[model samples]
Target: MPAITHEAEPAKLRLAVIGSGNMARRFLKQLPDSRRCVLRAIGDRDPGQARVLADEVGHLCEGDLICGTEDEVLTSDEVDAVYIATVHTTHAQLAMRAIAAGKHVLCEKPLTVNHVEAMAVVDAAQHAGVRLVEAIMFRFHPQMAAVRELVRSGAVGEVRHIDAGFAFYVPSDPKAATIVTPDLIIPDAGGLEGRLFDPHLAGGGILDVGCYPVSMVRAVAGAAAGVDFLEPVSLTADGSLSGDGVDEWAIAQLTFGNGVTASVRTGVRMVDNNTVQIVGSRGTIELLDPWALSPSPRVVVRRVGHEPEERAFPAPGAYALQMDAFAESVDGPEPEQVSNADSLGNAATLDRWRAAIGVRYPFERDDAVIPTVSALPLRVPAAAPGGDRAGTGRIEGLDKPLSRIVMGCDHQPDLLTASALFDHYVSLGGNVFETAHFYLDGQAERQLGRWIAARGIRDDVVVIGKGGHAPDCTPEAVSRQLVESLERQGTDHLDIYLLHRDNEDIPAGEFVDVLNQHADAGLVRVFGGSNWSVRRVAEADAWARANGKRGFSMLSNYFGLAEPDDLPWPGCLDVCDAESMRWLTERQLPLFAWSARSRNFFERADPADLSDEVLVRCFYGPENFERKRRAEKLARDHGVSPSAIAMAYVLHQPFPTFALYGPKRLDESRAAFRAVEIDLSPEQVAWLRGDQS
Candidate 1:
């Protein structure tokens, strides 16, 4: 590791404490002793509490310390950074606000309530160029450093297994219990009543105390493998939830890619051994007090055929070390601190642990659509007028204009994340959402439906519903699934519908007849086929035209800049080849291209990295690499990402085209939306596909 050098008289980082709770008080107590940072302000929901905290640390400031509400402190120029010691539910919101205000942040762990929020927060911080660190103070402790060194030095050769636990009994008292309901879990309220038992506040033992053992396991495993962190390949958990649905106790077993295994236990209402043990082939290492180091932290190493060795290291308060490290990291991140990736991995593990035990917060439930942290609609520039039909296209038999890019609704993990993504997409003028019956076993349709109902934008948006998937690809199944899809979506009629897969075993006219029946009954407006070959579609349309019924007007197939070398899933079709493109162009049928960017083929810069099996199987070949090369060149010329260039290629086809984009992050959606602004000439499109025109 390289040494971090500082100037002889380094400037002290002006810091503000965002919450005036017990954690904030502890941080303030350590602020006075930190040489690299100084207390500048204290903020809380209650001004009186903020003033109390400010008074205790006011003497350490060179000037008058500001004490006010959290918003005032965030906007104040006196503070350069903020330490968010608020409750679990408020962490993501406050961190986002702080990042938006352009202030460095040291957020308490686990970074947010779940991985979805953590990804958003981390991405925002990176995009804003603001330093953000999860305050897992133990990472900055000297004892952890010693442990990492020992693991890396072969003291515990080839680490094989790890056992860790962090639990303590917190007896339930009637007097200390606040109203155990979702409606009353207030944010930033300094009280100990039902704070740790309320699901709305993201209260539970796994998130509060379980993170310690999980993070330790990751760090120790990373040291053994010579990396910053190693995420578990698979994990299974068992636990008990409180009456309010918060986890009271849990145990998770994890297996890493490098053959390292671990078992971690945590709880707030149960007592267990609070230590970490790393077992290796040659020896074992144990920490007496891993999370909160004792005055003299000890590391016991027991080697094969040798006496047990005991080592002690001087222990400065972990919070003090964390504060100093965060101050230094304003310029650049410290090597020993908990990194953003580390925090994301830890949050994902906790999410899985909670999920395995069926512990879900109220906000994540199906009935609720948690608003964004700001609780204000995002402000985005409207689509440019008269450019590519104002970044939208008209579909036959559909009243609403569909955005050139359609949002795919399969990857969202929960309602909160789905709502946020939908909200952002709408703010960017995107109205079309693509949902299938098989996605997440119908959860996707339910989430999209709930979001539409919550926003009351059912009339303003065009929904694309798909049914008749494989193993149930019959007219009877289509009729049954359409009714369920409508109910799940909370709508009376679908703007557009498609058969998820073709069934050659049955005549194409039978499927067309079923869809037309739904159309006659006011359950469907526009009907089409997904993954159906040209012959099947032509036959279906012929039958519909002869019988005086509605027929296929659009298609959902794998079409993108790069020609797919193979299909990623069974019964999928590709229409990017010359013959299929010509056929579609001749018919002038609208194509809703799925896997539109070749499933991130253009986004990944390295051609040698084959870690993604789908990408390799579908898009890894000489022809696709050449296409990717051209996309990069064009992307540089247009001052956009290769992904944007690929999306533009899809939209620039001779026939009407709309790209189905499934973005797991906000930035990715933004990038896909930008493709509509890019205009590619005919020659450029031809050249991009290696055609000499």
Candidate 2:
């Protein structure tokens, strides 16, 4: 549909902001539909938030807008394009959804989870014939182009290495920063992590905000495309993983095919700002907020035989320009920037890093059989005084309905522990299991399958497995993945089946239909999401509600017990956010959480053996470390481990929390179970929450 431009010619750009949060809001307000563009709508799961954003944007905008769901906005007669600032994990999915919806898409940086998904997105868009661009908004900053031009012009010489810094000490200004679309852990284009700090999501420092430097590399070295076949002849990477699997800061050296080597590093858990330093054989360039080169974000070049010179350009907002480019592409060919190659390079680089660092993500496997959740003999209420009675102490609305701290007992090559870890959490009364058809290359699910078959305890445990990625999330795929999960778990059905991601391209309703079919087939009981938002959820729920079928009854969000630097899952907390919270609080849909520990502070808890970033922030930060200390003190006072206190904090919330625990040692499982029994007082919970009052 044509946009209602305020111009006398009645020209305007019809635009929608996907994942109406901080970046989306900023992207809209700044553009305010001059004669060139218009805000057509805002899409989000939380209609309240979407409405609020639309109202705010309307006040600032010159176009008509309606608050709606992703489907509404993407498929809207008014929406011609979208600027997505939704959480990171969904970056790839939603990007494709918007693109497939026949609208152009401008997504936040670090598109997709891994290279595989990244490539899939490129293919999907190509087949669908839509324009898609990674919203590395800063790239459009004229200053950014100036910096890149300076480097490309050989003013700084042949770029050999780069040192980029993107960090900030974000004081908790609920408004200073909009809540991350996905908690900090949402996966990046690297397929490394689900959060910025998650080594897996962030793909370490360089992979996190490192995209800026790499994008700059694309500019300076003129080497963004034709990179799939390019491998740094000799690359050595040494980095740190936070308690979970996030990378806080990382250093990697890669020698391109031409002998040009680059080094990249980034750490944001401590400081906040985006700066890039480039060193060529003949000179160097330095840029602050290199990614957002606007209104003065500058670049300086130093030559071998000359004084440092400053180069600047008047930059158009990257998001706006990208959107304009996307709009133009509809009438032309693909864009030179953020093209298919851009997505592929970003994704492939992340996968290579994973291969290089030996980082493992949940996406490694393709399918698994999901086990059916049976009615528990235990009368578990939603919540209790000390917390959920499942023993994690998280105050769910129900008691033994299920337990948090679901341990990954399947044998991982890196794991030195036995599959008997399940028995350990069970000994502590844990009644939840997390497995997938593709987990442990399928062995873990098999182990679970065997256990369920042998024990006949299906009624006592809740089984969760997710599907969709690098492949279709069709009913057949869902069935096959569930069968694999069942085969691995040795079960005929799953207690709960989660869509690892919403195949946004397939209409959210269609995705839910597959799960609903399985439920009908008795292959799974309840349906839920591993990385979905309320918008998608509502789309699914509305479809189900309208059809008189069961909708999502549970939400497995990326919830945990530490400060999240990025949105955990793309649009993860949809059901946990203020609006979703109220809905779930009353509707009784269980809230299951992964990464409950955020990779740190477990008592008998083994240190979080995650990628890297999480460990740094959760265990090293003043606030987190202090909490760990308090947990230690609490443990000393209560005769438990500090880690137990951390788990206890999660258990104290008003939701059913399920944590995925992967302990290399059997003793670690023993320690994680103790968390079920550590009854924390409200005071202790508050202290852990940093609420001294």
lDDT digits (tens) for residues 1-693 of candidate 2: 997866455445677788766667667756743345677788897878899887776775454567888778778877777877776566766776676678777667777656545654555566567767776656555565566556656766666776655533322332343222211322222311234544334334544465665555544444322232244556576555566655555556666766566665554444534567788878888875565445545667788889888766555566667666666666677665556676566566655555565555543332322111111122223445654454542223222356667765444442111323444345456677776554667666656655555456676677767665335556578777777666655667776677766566677777777777788888877777766776677788899888887778767666555555555334434233467656655666566666665554444233444445545433445565566667778888988766666666766765555556666544456566777777777777778777883
TM-score of each: 0.86, 0.48
Q: Quote the RMSD, in angstroms, for model 2.
A: 25.4
Question: lDDT per residue, candidate 1, 437-478, as tens digits?
Answer: 999999999999988887777878899999999989999999
Question: Which numbered prediction scores highest in TM-score against the true structure?
Answer: 1
In TM-score terms, candidate 1 sits at 0.86
| Model 1 residue 595 CA deviation in Å | 1.5
The lDDT per prediction is 0.86, 0.60
Model 2 quality (TM-score): 0.48
